[model samples]
Target chain A: MNAAAAYLTSFLRASYRDAVAGWNRFWFAPTDPATLAMIRILAGAMLLYTHLVWTIDLEAFFGPHSWVSPTANATFHEVPKISEIMEQDPYRGRSFVWSLFDVAKTSQQIWAVHIVALVTFALLTVGLWTRVVAVLAWIFAVSYVQRAQGALFGLDQINTMLAMYLMVGPSGACYSLDAWLARRKNPRRGAASPSTSANIAIRLMQLHMCVIYMFAGIGKFVGASWWNGTGLWGGVANLEYQSLDATWLAYWPHLSAFLSHLTVYWEVFYCVLIWPRALRPWMLLIAVPLHLGIAFFMGMITFGLIMLVGNLAFVSPESVRATVSWLFRRTRPAPTTGG
Target chain B: METSSRPKADDRHQACCPWPNELRIVVSLLLALHVSAIYVGPFSMGAMGVTSPLALTLRRTYRPYLEAISTQYQGYQFFNEPGPSHLIRYELEFADGREMVTGKLPDIDEHWPRLRYHRHFMLTETAYTLVSRTAPPTPPPGLEVGTPAYESWRQFRDADAALSRAFLKSYAEHLMSVHGASLVRLYGIERRYPTPEEVVDGIRPGDKRFVSEELLDTFTIDIEVVSP
Candidate 1:
């Protein structure tokens, strides 16, 4: 009996040690900031463009006489009394959801805040004062989403997700104006060092993406169309959602069904398959076609593009740097031979 | 000439695990709490109406943090069940005896740069979601009226009605303000897509037969607000 107990204790000890080591390695290991920097430029550009588009109808969406006026917004954000009775009121008596628009009651005030938000996003994109601007960008992104909850879609969610994580790391460590400024001040400074914070940021983005797809895949199981593999047909035939007419897919039912099944299987297994180095490439490659298809075929170009930006978290810093360098080399003029 | 001072392979390897043990522990604990919050957000918004009690508890515990970050509503269920699309049709009557003006929420020609159109599209969809409350579930066997189950369902119904009225009224008021209109009427239109069989049968996806409309509400300019 003593022998058996001793063996069990040893096995438990080994397992516990292994688990701790794995956890530490996964979350704490330092990584080059190249991947995070690239994500920042892309995501920041998206945030800027998204807010810029709001300029088209600034008064209609965000002004005092906006689509979702302050009074109506208050009602929407109020905790339902029924939820309170059931002890399920997430916000209790008061709401924590906030936005600058909550206080910007006048058109002038709204426009002022909107301009500042646009500038913050542009700064984040250019990597100027990146740390401060990254945080500001997140605050502004969330503020817009919270205030205009009626006009949101997956694009805003992914935008806020990317912006939130960008604040968690040294996202301007390289490929940024900050880097250039630093080099100008001290000509001998080396490339940006690796950082645990960068790793944490990228890991969070990758895990969050996995959670999104996992839910998305599992959620489809509740629908009969997904089960019968006609889910793709539903999207293709939706006149409102169609950007480019893909009704031709009606004739290729087998191909449509194959794509539908492939999407579900890929999304469901992404979290598991994406961790392995060998499978990671295949997973990311599949993302391009899936997301691009949505971008072109459906009318959700911004949503599809932002999702692809989120997927970039899975790419390694080394790979990002190599790819960027290769593109620059191809773009640069060949060195002319001196006579 | 500028010399590249990139770190060597050995240097890079050495830099991989530079965090002190104490910092690692703190961050690990924080990460554990954060990732738990992240998972709980979607888990609480369960698939197939099968949320676990544990997910609810965790979500409640993390509610404040999630709300502050505006991550509380992270369902991530994009196109999970792409069903019928929605649009709001509005008719406005001006107090100045002007002709009635009529329009849709997302007139494809009026809203440009697809994203703007999408925003308007979402407004109609949000209205549909708010107003389209299903019938309350039938009470379980042996549970008659006035029981806890029945009362709970009744409270939900009442709350939903109040919320929907608030949204529709606000939308009506906006239209009145926008068009100098004293009277506003709003309709929720559900645009169902054609099935593959229907498509093959020469019926277009946007056939009027597939469109269904329900009058959501009608509102007049609030006398109190207009006089004040």
Candidate 2:
């Protein structure tokens, strides 16, 4: 009896150790920082551009006399049940968050805050003072996002998310003014070694993307239209959202069905298919066109582009470095000295 | 491509990576919490039950808070439900008896300018979402005068409907004022259109050409009139 108990204890200990070790290796393994930095530049540009869209009718959405007056906006935040789901008020700012809305009572103040946000976004894109400004950029993203809660959509939500995760790591590690400054400070040294920070950030993004797509795919089952392939038509047929009306596809029901089914299956199984190195290229091939199609045909250009950017986490760092090098005419950091 | 050699602790330029076992454990825990924070929302909504006793208790306690935060981050259930789509159009009669009509608040120009105005329609859609997407409370059985639950719903309906009306009034005022009208009587309506497939399938009669404008609300702006 005593011998059997001792063997069981040993087996349990070994199993626990093995599990912990595997978890550590899977998540904390060092990875190159290039992909994350590239994502920052692209996503930051997206953030800047999205906020830039707000400028066309600056006060129409936020001013007291505007569409959503301050009183209505406050009701949107304070009212329970309705606001919780509909308004999507951020929990952190129930009482009030620093919106340019509060101080930008006048159109001049509104544009002033808007310009500062744009500058911050530009800096974040180029990776200047990233550690500090990334947080500031997040503040800007959140403030505008919550303030413009009425106008929010998939584009704003995902933009704010990428902004949050970008702040999690050393996102300025490459393809940035900060990266060049680092090399300038230590010119003799080759590019720095891969860090656990980059790996963790990429892992979180990958995981978060999985959650998004999985739920997005699953959510379709709730609707009768998705089952019948009518939901896909709904996007194009709705004249309000239609840009390049391909409702002509009504005659080609077979093609419409194929594309609709492809989207659902691709999204539902993305998290699994994405992990395999061999399937990675194929998944991207399907995803890029799917997103670009939405942008062009469906008229949700920013939302579609942001969705594509979310998939950028799956891209390998080496490819990012090569692309950057190609663009800048060999301006990237010297190839790494260590693996 | 990664280089042949590996980085060392005493490298010429330092790289800070928390590579210790304890730190990795901490990271694992943090990642787990973060992932869980996102997961619980879709799970609870999708009926992916947590069967374990401890898990169920923890979920029951923290699920509401997490649902709010998670939704704020990414409510990616876009187009999961299918229904009639609407566009608001307003017609205004100035005190001088001249009348004006506009597509909606956004009525933005073509190309890039249209993207900016998508927000106006988004606001209207949100009101529709609040009204239609939410499961209306099952009116409670006791109907003497004012049961607490019924009263709560009564208050909600008034607030919710009033909001929709208020938005119509405000935008109507602003848009009409732009047309050189000081005082205007405005009536708002929505054009309800069916999906392409709906028309093709004849879900109802006249689906193909079914374009009906539902009267949303009628109100006065900077002028006294009968309540609508």
Candidate 3:
């Protein structure tokens, strides 16, 4: 048993290291203002939008009369959301195992924490006091999720992961007022100017994203739905649960099953393939489409897009330059030999 | 002299502009679109594939609105003709005999307490009057059908649940604050990820005897929310 534990630990560590190395090769470009700006704004806007939708009374679609809410509670029934099991049910312990960490309370103190979270998200988006904002946003998001207990929705999980990623990345390095100010304070600092702090931060984010994907995939495998090739199909097909028909999946019902099987394989195998030198780029390319599918089809646009952005961490500067130039229709000039 | 002349060819080349361009505005627009899609996009469109933004906007702009016409207040029941949006009219009652009807308030001079609107759909003709001694005024018709009130109710429930969980946590710590741990004991439930069965068992204890099954019939999951 001890040997098995060691083997598992070693495997996870290898996976982690491989994922980081891939990220460094693919994603770590000499910090660009444009890329950084887009990431921060997108993340911030998503946070704000979630809060707005949650706070508003636009119940026409999700109201009691609408299909989602149950008028009278039932003992045992099919859940209205496919993600509910993955997102909420795992934590629905009967007794409070760790009550102090639980924020499920109506106390003024709890509300105060919520307010702080709202502020933290706002600050994190604008890149104002970014380091502090990142810390606070991560804390607040995790705490809010913890407070929601087992009732947490998919968005909460996504938000928690996003915050975790942001804490380790150069999320506030560009397009932020803070970044602009920092640049102004030190005009000579250029893209190639490396700071120990920023380097550490970026590396951490890359490592964190790898773990997130690997763990998520591992969790899916643990569930029967993934193994049976019914998870993705069920998610797309259920009427009360699915937000859209996506019934086009029926035309190639076999395709749906294939996709589900593919997802599980991709998740589990991604951890293995992400680290291999020859296969890393191909694996990343596949990941791009998978994430896009999630964004486009799952009403999980934010999560998909964010994960895609996180995948960018695997790209290297030279390769990125080549890719960018190719995308922009630019040709590289020939190098002069000892001019 | 020729080599010295080459030195002056251009110091300006060394000062090349390498700063990356700003994509903030474009990114911001895309983010805004992504967020708005939640409301305007086909409710199910999100679950399908990228919903058409144009279609989403059109649906939102053209969505129907429910309006309320009249309201009547009675002893334990409130009656209101909340215009066309409501399918069934409603009356609310309290255990203490205080009730409000669907119609207008008693005083016309004050606009604050007036019934603004009413609308309901997908609800049966049944009436529900929660007989709570401490319950606040049952939510109004227009309010109940809307998302805000429901979310508020969820928030309220979550907050209350949190408090209950906390109260159970410090069972030993608060022992001295009271007479002793013996006087007041709190048992925290140890449910390590509750299954559907556990949630049901917790809400409805099997020990209670029912006089008739008809009372229990109200607990059916298929019952729809009546909108008045």
Interface RMSD of each: 1.7, 5.4, 22.4
Report the alpha-carbon TM-score of model 1 versus the true structure: 0.93
**A1-339, model 1: which lDDT tens digit per residue?**
999999999999999977876776688788999999999999999999999999998888877677877777777777353334455765667777899888887988999999999999999999999999999999999989888868899999899999999999999999999999999999999999988899999999999999999988888888888888889888878887899888887788898899999999999999899999999999999999999989888888999899999999999999999999999999999999999
Among all candidates shown, the one with the greatest DockQ: 1
Residue pairs with backbone overlap in model 1: none
The digit string of per-residue lDDT tens for model 2 on A229-338 reads 76677677666677786777777887777777788888899989999999998998898998888888778888888888889899999988887778787675677887
Q: Worst ten-residue run, lDDT, model 3 chain A?
A: A73-82
Give the DockQ (2 decimals) of all models: 0.52, 0.32, 0.02
Model 2 stretches astray by more than 4 angstroms: A1-8, A82-100, A326-339, B1-17, B20-27, B41-73, B93-111, B131-159, B162-166, B169-208, B222-227
Which tens-of-lDDT digit does each residue in A30-100 have in candidate 3? 34334333455666666755544433222221222221122121101111211221123332322111211
| Fnat for each model | 0.62, 0.41, 0.00
lDDT of 2 by residue, B1-228 (tens): 857587753341223334765776687788888788676545544422113444344444444555343243254676676455555666655667675644554454632565676777687676555444333445545743476556656656666665554555665556655565544443333444555556567443224455565555555665343454
Where does the lowest 10-residue lDDT sum fall in candidate 3 chain B?
B66-75
Question: lDDT score of model 2?
Answer: 0.69
The DockQ score of candidate 3 comes to 0.02
**CAPRI class of candidate 2:** acceptable
For each candidate in turn, the TM-score is: 0.93, 0.81, 0.44
